[model samples]
Target: MGRAPCCDKANVKKGPWSPEEDAKLKSYIDQYGTGGNWIALPQKIGLKRCGKSCRLRWLNYLRPNIKHGGFSEEEDNIICSLYISIGSRWSIIAAQLPGRTDNDIKNYWNTRLKKKLLGRRKQQQQLHPATTVEHDHHHHQDHQQSPTSTSNGLSNSALERLQLHMKLQTLNQNPLLHNMLWPKLHPFQEKLLLQAMNDENSNNNIMQLPLLPQPIMMESPLSNIGNMMNNNNINVSSYGGAFQLGGGDFMMGNLDNGTTSSLVWWSNEFETNDVNYDRSGSFSSSSNDSSWDCALRSSDDAGLF
Candidate 1:
């Protein structure tokens, strides 16, 4: 069975409470309060209004300090933030703002706040169209330059670096750089590069290296390793027979003579020099491709080469 109505529909007044009605509701509530019963309060006041209508009038309008419209910047921010988090729980949102009603916030959000945000967004798009376009262009470039793309099976950056290395005559002279660049190259790939080096008929010094694993292309260049370590505040030095830093046992490499520090090599600048051929018929160049150029070798280490 349906529930009975709280008040007689025929006798009750509805919509837009008059000034007299507002005064009566406010005056009675201020003096005696709703007497813990809203359904009986309208009858005591003799307002001819429903209990719900009287309650709404008292709480939303007739109540002192009940704010309506003209929300402040702080209130707007609070409303927007709460809306994003809680989503249309206007009663909870209303609780956060001292004098604002749930209905007022809901109406303002629907009619004004939403449109205001949308208009501001549109203005931004119009003002900075190039920014959006540039972002999309960068995204497209990243997608195109992915590792899957073909350039001897290398990513765009790696391929560019490789091409740059190929142009330098120094690369043909040093085999150590090749080993460093491709630390784990397969035997077949090594054979192909060796064959290319031996080919006398090859017009240009540039040799096509086989498709290597992505890690080979991504290894940090030796020149930048010092800078990277310095940025992270890593101070490498031999302490207690172990190459360590900041009291932590890092175990980077073997110590030189147990006393000589590797900090000189780690901290030194790797400056490039002009390319030159060695006297032993092997073309050697004092550049980044030649690791021997940077190494501080003594007469005792001559036979190790």
Candidate 2:
């Protein structure tokens, strides 16, 4: 059933507030407060306006002691801090800063502050294009820097083990993708490393494996998961506190014990197109998914093994 209108839409003033209307609203409010019921305020004041509109105009524009100028540095800091802690609940944030309306704060954030932050980020990325690259290099140098391992983080060893465990699990599940990643070996590198370690021959050819490009090792396990899911009719998204996924498309055994916390696939670019990188370090896309050379497969194929 259709819901009833809140007020007579045809009878209300709908555009920019004229000077006379603003003066009338201001004069009416100066004589009496909102009376805690905005719906009744417009009618009592003889305004041909919706009650909600009257309330918004009064609160945002006609409120006493309202600050209409640019926000100060202190106000900016307050808004940023509150936003970080409580997110974009502008009304609550506005309550913390007196004389600042929620709508004003929102407009400032969307039009100015957000762009300012993004501009800073773009500047940094342009200034230090190799920042992440250098970071990854230093990470490697740390391990090779000393045999005793000078890292102060006590959990580093456990974290490394967890990472390897995750990589191994993903490799096992998607051998074809892993095979392409290791161009020099057909899934023999990791297996060889494990074999050498088990046989106490870790100083052999396996030692050379670490010299190879380590970026691919850090590539996400579920790298193309969005495409895989889309191809499989699986819709994955987060709601409230947990990951949610449900469809009668697959076996119940694949759904594990109600926890999708480990399935960390966070990319939204899963268009069914192929991405190609030429020798000049530029990428081009093909028109059709069939022509693409992606290592990913339909989740159906991945599940077969």
The lDDT leader among the candidates is 1
**In candidate 1, what are the lDDT values of residues 99-180, reduced to their tens digit?**
9888889888766664443233245347633211111113454354233212222223232222222322234433323323
Predictions in order: lDDT: 0.46, 0.43
lDDT of 2 by residue, 101-196 (tens): 999998786556543432342453475442111111233543442222112121222222222332434544332233222112223224433343
TM-score of predicted structure 1: 0.40
What are the RMSD figures for all models against the true structure? Answer: 25.1, 20.1
TM-score versus the correct structure, for each prediction: 0.40, 0.41
Clashing pairs in 2: none
RMSD of 1: 25.1
